[model samples]
Target: ADGARGLLAMRQAGARTIAQDEETCVVFGMPREAIELGAAEKVLPIEAIGIEALRMAGEPKEGIGSRGAA
Candidate 1:
């Protein structure tokens, strides 16, 4: 429950969360736990993860599109 509690605290503090997509994860342990615990708000690929996080962090952006899409 430690990780859950920490995530809960962050949520209470109005913080958003992003987890690297399972496809990009080496060990889908903590992130999987967090996702199952209702912690992560967004799960994105490694390349998109940073942009997603920045977007949630209130960064102004031109736009966001799935980079993997062609």
Candidate 2:
């Protein structure tokens, strides 16, 4: 709950925030809370989370078509 609130605050401060999707969670409490609080801009599966984060950070992903990719 506290972590969700912190993510909310970060979003309110204009940060790009993401939460893990419910289907992929072993414990959905935190991510569900964050989603309910409108903290996450994107809710993604666990496998894709790292790649999405890399994309958001402007890092190349070889053939993954992310930002800065050539």
- Maximum-lDDT candidate: 2
lDDT of 1 at 43: 80
Candidate 2: clashing pairs of residues: none
RMSD in Å for candidate 2, one decimal? 6.9
- Count clashing residue pairs in model 1: 0
- Give per-residue CA lDDT, model 1, range 32-68, as digits (tens): 8778777877788889987777676675323442255
Per-residue lDDT of candidate 2, residues 1-70 (tens digit): 9999999999887677889999999999999999999999899999999998888778533445435646
* Candidate 2: residue 57 Cα off by (Å): 0.9
Candidate 2, run of 10 with poorest lDDT: 60-69
Error of 2 at 7 (Å): 0.2
lDDT of each: 0.72, 0.87
lDDT at residue 13 of model 1 (Cα atoms):
60
List where candidate 2 sits over 4 angstroms from the true fold. Answer: 59-70
